[model samples]
Target: FADPSQAYDEQEASQEEERDGQYFEPVVPLPDLVDVSTGEENEQVLFSHRAKLYRYDKDLSQWKERGIGDLKILQHYETKSSNCAQTIGSLPI
Candidate 1:
């Protein structure tokens, strides 16, 4: 009998490989946690992984991680307004 955990691991590895191929490295570090909100005042795209939330800094031309304590995100949603973009996430307290 095939081990369920092993099967799950293999499946996850295959999915990771597929994701890696689709998303170029260095550009998107964490694709699953990355999202874009497009509206009028440009788009607010962000990325997050584990406890760190990252935003693109135009002046620095780099992705900067925000230090907001140990944040455990259950889910995240990006909302766009006429002139702004917002990202809302469910974090465990």
Candidate 2:
């Protein structure tokens, strides 16, 4: 038997050609880390370099920022990498 992913690859290719070059773009949004941990008054902040725990708030529909007083700077980096084995590919799974 051939490699298992070969058939899967062929199927994907066929689908791609049939669509006349339109492709599915992954809709990965920036994780909006919302933290009012430094209290509700301070809108501007410099985050600690070591802070890592994140809290998600369902009611407010955002993440509550922690380690506010400890952070030195806020840097936003948007990076993408896929671990196919762990990916929930073609969702509606």
Candidate 3:
């Protein structure tokens, strides 16, 4: 009788080959020009620190951990207006 294990291996190999044969084209063509805008491009970071934030709960009479993120103080180049931001990755928290 044919080795059951060998048959299973052959079947798996054929399935992998079938998967490799399939091709997918992009539904939409890539743009020639792409602008990488992060909104903070115009601004300059005055300060950046990795910190953990907390809030005091009056009802619970305890401190609650808000989140841990990069705390940044940004200042605009032209306007010179400064602001603080707590962000996790590229997102504001």
The residue pairs in collision within model 2 are: 34-63, 35-64, 35-65, 47-71, 47-72, 48-70, 48-71
Candidate 3: Cα lDDT at 36: 79
Please, what are the lDDT tens digits per residue for candidate 2 over residues 25-85?
A: 7799777887645221323223434333457999999987532222233322332221111
CA lDDT for candidate 2: 0.46
- What is the lDDT of every predicted structure here? 0.52, 0.46, 0.90
Error of 1 at 14 (Å): 0.1
lDDT of candidate model 1 versus the reference: 0.52
Candidate whose TM-score is highest: 3
Q: TM-score per candidate, in order?
A: 0.25, 0.24, 0.58
Cα lDDT for residue 10, model 1?
Answer: 99
- Report the number of clashing residue pairs per model: 0, 7, 0
Error of 2 at 74 (Å): 14
* Per-candidate RMSD, Å: 20.2, 17.2, 6.0
Top lDDT hit: 3
Under the 3 Å rule for N, CA and C atoms, how many clashes does model 1 have?
0
lDDT of 1 by residue, 1-93 (tens): 999999999999999988885754596565576565432234333433335557899999999875443332222234443222234343322
